[model samples]
Target: MPHLNGVTVHPDCRHFRGDIPCRPNKEYGYQCQDCPVYAPTQQRILIIKLGAIGDVIRTTPLLRRLRQEYPNARITWLTLTPAILPQSGGWIDEVLKLELTSVLHLQQREFDLLFNLDKDKEACALLGSIRAHQKFGYQLHPQYGVAWPVGELANHKYLTGVFDELSQQNQKPYVQEIFELCGYEFQHEEYVFDTHDDKGYDWSQLPQGRPRIGLNTGCGDRWTTRLWSDEKWITLINQLQQAGYAPVLLGGEAEAERNQRLHAATGAAYLGTFPLPQFINLMHQMDGIVTQVTMAMHISIALRKPTILMNNIFNPYEFDLYGRGQIVQPDKQCVCFYRGSCKLGPTSCMEDLSAEKVFEAVRVSVPLA
Candidate 1:
């Protein structure tokens, strides 16, 4: 572990000074500020996390607990603009988009503490400007800024476990942990979307009666991890419709061509023509979701709606933290862990994942039948 020039790890930092505020207030049922777990000092803190959608979702509990720990203190989160504010809901008091070059100017306003959820070199360098009383994250890369070597992160451990280790000096805020760290329970509430009413959606055009199920055929940027085949998707859509489900297709503009192909192939309802928010609106109206390890999965988790995650490039062990779904892994024992591309062309993990198997998992999760 590297060490920051002037920073030291406070091994004896305790949690919960027991200054909890009243529960069920006018704003939040329980205002996080009243919790005694926050530090006794009034300090301005900043949390940094920049990654894919799911990684950001896993950090919610940490942010919530931090707020509870220091209700009187100011907490600002550093992340992409898209992942902040409107999408963030009240997780952090403020969000500072990570624009290092531009933030160089704001370095004049110092921070009392800096928390790093990601360890990119560029991001760490930017933290050098802010005068943080306490700096937390992986040790800087050799010649960078801070040098505090946190422990190695295990791939097998859930997302919560990895973050728990980073904040171990404080408290593990996961709701499912053995010890109640923050003295407050973490609840997975429905994703609160503030619709500005500036969008248009044709809800009346959607078929009525049967449960709505969203089918996702595309994976993330990485194609090797996708386990579902187009043919299988077509088969699944047919099976779902026959089994009394109103299957709807969901994806981004990047999926336009694939969505068109799938629509032509299976004749299922394609809602990709609408804008992104409109697509989200449709997702919100749906009864359930079926997808791979993509952003849609995170939305479904926040929705607390029953979901079925098809493990494509990764396994259930990689993303089992945000529960509320059945993870469908590959049947082939040949490649246990996701090995880049299959030695024999496209791996069967995703392609071989049968619609029948998926439908079974769906039935078990949502009980469509």
Candidate 2:
């Protein structure tokens, strides 16, 4: 008798597959539910997607597909941040914070399958070291030179990132590309909001009125070229108020001062700021989101709220809004496509976008009621 996960693997069982725990061989009349390895040696799955919040949130759709593929498996996730994905939700059994010790400890375990979708060097390097019966997505070279896709299905995604021309030419949506890398069909899968981040609030009390629209001002620090100017936001807010919609300012502490200025300038309610969880909940109170591409945009889409998304740096085709929103780009063509930095110096391409374009888009996307 050989033991794995402290369960005996019967020598006579036909489900023995080299070095792995034995499974039930129905043809041999050996049922796994009746066997010693049933409980302790059940399928174990691991997922590694560490974050910048928005990426982690967008990646939540995989939980559904992974569960569909491995119903019996108890899934464990490794992430840099905690609580972005559900640990209490029925789908995920555990979430291990990414640390050296945690990685080394996880390395000791045997998994039936593993999925690593993060393009980070750290994640790719770890994926290369992990032991799994099967692995999908990118892997760092053994010498840790660079990350590359582990499967041919991921080749397109890999090539797109490796070559700027390919990225510009690629027409596949970001979500679809990621799903293909995992050998899973996209099927128009949507993200699940199991994040325990909700602090909850009374929606009736928070500036209730016709067509409450959130003006998300910040777009993170990585892509400066992607951000629309504060002048543009102020102009849009002023226009929105005149158009009979209550525009509320939305952003982290980074935009607190800017929100104050916008609020004072336009009387657009500065509903004030909250932590990430509370902010997300506040976003739920809004009827529509008018935002530059950011984490709020991801939340809005996840909640299925209609939006007028502004995009300039990235290609419009990269975003799949699931028909719940419309993308409004500047009148002028962007010189910085996929490049986080601007090529036009002080005169940004997003400056070409007018308040009328966004206002009209918002009106059409979520008509004021």
Candidate 3:
């Protein structure tokens, strides 16, 4: 064993770790001073986007722009759902879960730039506490104790979030708004999703020779107003089957029972629920996706799957399908805009969104062989 000197360590190297040997040394036995692959950290960027998983997936597009702007930056993303974020070998050098340990670590570290995209109180408060030379997006207002826009760029998003009427009138998609928040122009940068292709998930059970269409049946529990009737899903499934496409029921544990019933009723393929990575792999098999404005919709967009997005309560313009999908809404406008439950007793505008319209969109999106 040889004695190591403080001068021998390259602390600014992107791969440098004080507590353990870096990857270059571990694999090739190269000391930090002689490491051929050593890349110095140009900038340290911290992004706080504690999420609803869908937002986390959509926020991935920002990573591309960030990489382009700061090629050698060591980007650290602090999020509630770390699992949903891109893993190693991606733009993000570190994915820290929003917990006490991560909070403490972040407090001690300094960043060249900090972006707190989320308006949540905790997220804003964290942004306030962090030591960053420059900050963008929202921050906790010291006087108001509420999240407020840090700069003029963030004002548009902030106003839209606070005022429903403004949101309704806004035509800018989510990706553009986030890009503007960071003072960058939106160039239709694609999402950086970790498809877990290396996992080698066997999806042979799925029917072949026909275009596989994924029908994500759940809109999540928070927004029950977005839920479509079983009759509509069944109708769409039957229509897809008749139109020479394979309709595959997709959902998580919350939708397991409903998906099972849909499968039994229409005899469409239902492969069952899976963990996030596995579920994403299953969705990867689809030629197209039909879903409400839920996590599945974001995932579908990330996967570049042609999608038919059903909307009722939220602004259709809020979503950017990357031109791969179309938004289908009810004939009658929803009275429950931005609502969790239908205001109209025992009926919803989602009922007016005909299954035929969705089927037609699917046919156009993923046409027959």
Candidate 4:
């Protein structure tokens, strides 16, 4: 009913922004009244999954199902790591970082559907505060002052999160669990990632005529229990090189010194770590990947590269590699389940998982050229 200049403004349009000029208008100088690319927002959906970068990346599979279910929905994702999320032409219409400003803005809006995947108190609290016609996943219980599942569908995932034994017994992959929580069945939906191919990054330093294997050396600082020894990595590098595959070292700034040492020791291709987007592009160049249950593993899976996931602490069933990778565990069962530090003091099950075992898994899993 209201006019901006000569054209009537449609607030329900997906591209309509009250504060700034809409994208369609800015790009094509088109008014809201007769805009050709006017996509009306049907439902407003909020997804609250503020967690680790890897967790954020893995949660992307739900977008596929959401788009199919709500084709005209204006989806907004709230996360701690916004950069990890796919930007343009992706499922999410808006990506908001978890902060006071974002919280204030979110509190002002009402959604048709709200899904708070994280069980954290802050996340649950936000879920309780947000106005939505239908709510799913966890929410903060006002009386108990704790996070509780919204419905029976979320009970399984909630129980697993609380109890280690139940989590270990869970045969369902993460995608299936999330789908069930949202009242849908899992259908092998793939991760939606922006590979950043248009960046034009030159990766010619890696030798040609050989399959490039990315060796993600770090398991992040939080989970030191998942870390493999440097000696074992060196051995794996040598094994890869001998097998006619180019071994490339991949890690974040935390693993820079170790990666440098490994590179110097084994003459492996080590293009020092770049930013998140550039690092993703670097992983894209790899034919296969060998990594602990870290961000690299998620990135490799999203890229659809054949991967050898060296795991011990977490449940193997939790990860869905989309039939592109194999999970290799240690011969000795890990005493510390879901722990940051090894309960067995000096001895670790990771030592039991030898370089030869990993190399063999790589050879079998990765289709070498």
Candidate 5:
């Protein structure tokens, strides 16, 4: 009998890189496949999702499913926002940031399966060049050719971005479609938001006996029209206070100045900016969150906080709030779906979606019981 059990230890060894061995320390003083003292490698899987932060957070529904399907697989996730890795608990064994060194390291080894969800050219190109036993999601752009979404699951996601009509007609929420890409059922899968941060927030400073509502000021630069006018936010702030809710201001460095103005104008508690981890911890205090289709909205949904989503340009159906929140849209039918700017010019569709309607959505009796 061989010195080993003749069983491949791919799930317990360090050198095993799919079929390519990366032996180091001269442990066996020979190639791994030829060695008798081989320790098997854990089932290796790689998940690639570079960020806009929101996308990074939402992609986590795959974690529970991936764990169920490949229980012993040592998973490695690649992303730009390294902060989220800790938040994922130990679901992922390794967190590789997008960089030249990380790229080279990935290319050096082969994965049992590599799932690249990013549509960005760089990610697709890397997916094309990497040596994986199997790849799902988008793949490389052939020489001078455009990158293509690989499977039937990605076809709808791919076309939605390529054409106007497809996106308008797309009824699938991003989470459901992405789950399908990984060969899993939607079944109301939720996002994982537990970070390593154990910081505690003092909610004592907030006004008593009032619904603590968060008003996120910025909608990000991608879609300027997605943002309600400053006057509109101010209007909502006044309305929120009148309705006996304590409106707290939430935003990033970009919105600090804007939030400050809103804060001063409305006398709302301005919880100044903190790091992402601390910020996430602070969000727990909110009874509800009001924002456009932004990262704050994703965070609130993950926390299962009552979120009042303000949508104008994108399909409201694309968001799966898990039955925890209400989606408020403009009374006007969006003419420019998935578009950055509106065809209606100065008269934005949002103007018709009045502050009163959004306020109604924000005050939903209580946070879903």
Candidate 6:
């Protein structure tokens, strides 16, 4: 992960001194009350989380809650156009795509409240421009505004305690607190992307109603650790086909080589290099998702699709559970959890997980064929 640089704090900076009426109040950390950007009951709110698909997935539940709290409020999610695309819903009236070109122009909107989800220095600096009445996010480290600074939860007892600080009450239900802080109420059911169409793939080429299974063979750069070897994936898909399940290869151009290799090995269904929205729709068509630990896994969870996540170093406890998948770990416990790459040669943890084991796990977790 990239550490925060001095770019977070410019030399000619506007510091949040308590003396300035517009300065953020420190009593509630950056949850300012007297600041010119401190209006809690505004009719309009702006939410910011500009990158990382997983982070975007996690931040979405907060949107539902924000809607529940203020039904009449016009809520907008301001996110980088490429990194995320929020769905139109009861909670969000509009998704304002935050292109780099218009970031400075945000000052004109005069938003009621702004929640900075990504805490990057670039985002912090940009917040200086939004004419919001309230600004809520992490307190800048004495050095880098809010660049991953140790926050109010530095002395936290449990992992959940960290999220508690940003919320209204820690003891409340998890989803409830998440909504309350985002200023909305939430429905407990997971979110699912509508996937009714055949997507843009050459679906007409394949037989109709084939018992298809989806395979996500690659994770984005951040989650390369969870990626299984091409050899192992090919082996597993072939085994599934022998048992009568028609396996379908799925991925973006990023995983085109891996998908081709697997398809060659199995002579199975393949949806290669389609547009993202169409690819996602195709994924939804499959019986279930077999993937590495990535945003697709989270998407599968939200869709309530049975998913098996092949993990090399990820802990099952750390994530919301996926019903039938096995988590592969090294015989020797891993030292890195949230940071650093697996330095061990060949990544013994995942490489050791045999095709038979993965196949059996998937079979039991998902109805065979």
- What is the C-alpha lDDT profile of model 3 across 305-362, one tens digit per residue? 9989999999888898888968999999788889987888777789999999999899
Please give, for residues 1-369, the per-residue lDDT of candidate 2 as tens digits.
566687555433324444553334544545444664443426778889897778887888888897777666677889877766765556676678998878988888878888888789988988878899999888887675688889798799899988878888999988888899888889888887753334446555556657789889888777877778778888888788888888888998888888898888878887677766677788877889988888888888887789789999886888888998799998888988766787768766888988889999888888766
Question: Model 6 scores what on Cα lDDT?
Answer: 0.59
**Candidate 6 weakest lDDT stretch, 10 residues:** 6-15
Off by over 4 Å in 5: 1-42, 195-197, 201-204, 365-369
Residues 127-234 of candidate 6: C-alpha lDDT, one tens digit per residue: 666777776653345565555422333222123434533332334443343344443444563542344353344566443554566788888776455667888888
Q: Please list the residue runs of candidate 1 whose C-alpha ends up more than 4 Å from where it truly belongs after superposition.
A: 1-41, 83-89, 100-102, 144-202, 273-275, 321-323, 334-340
Per-prediction TM-score: 0.72, 0.86, 0.97, 0.97, 0.86, 0.71
lDDT by residue (tens digit), candidate 1, 82-156: 442344344455566767644764477677767665656555665555667766554355554643333333111
Off by over 4 Å in 2: 1-42, 195-198, 202-205
Task: Encode model 4's per-residue lDDT on 89-174: one tens digit a residue.
Answer: 74888999999999998999999999999988999999989899999999988799899999898999899999999999999998
Provide C-alpha RMSD values for all models, in order: 10.4, 6.7, 1.9, 1.2, 5.7, 12.7
For model 1, what is the error of residue 105's alpha carbon versus the real structure, in angstroms, after optimal superposition? 4.5
**Candidate 4 regions with alpha-carbon error over 4 angstroms:** 1-6
Choose 2 or 3, whichever is better by lDDT: 3
Model 1 is weakest, by summed lDDT over 10 consecutive residues, at 9-18
The local lDDT score (0 to 100) that residue 266 gets in candidate 1 is: 72
Q: What is the lDDT of residue 146 in candidate 2?
A: 87
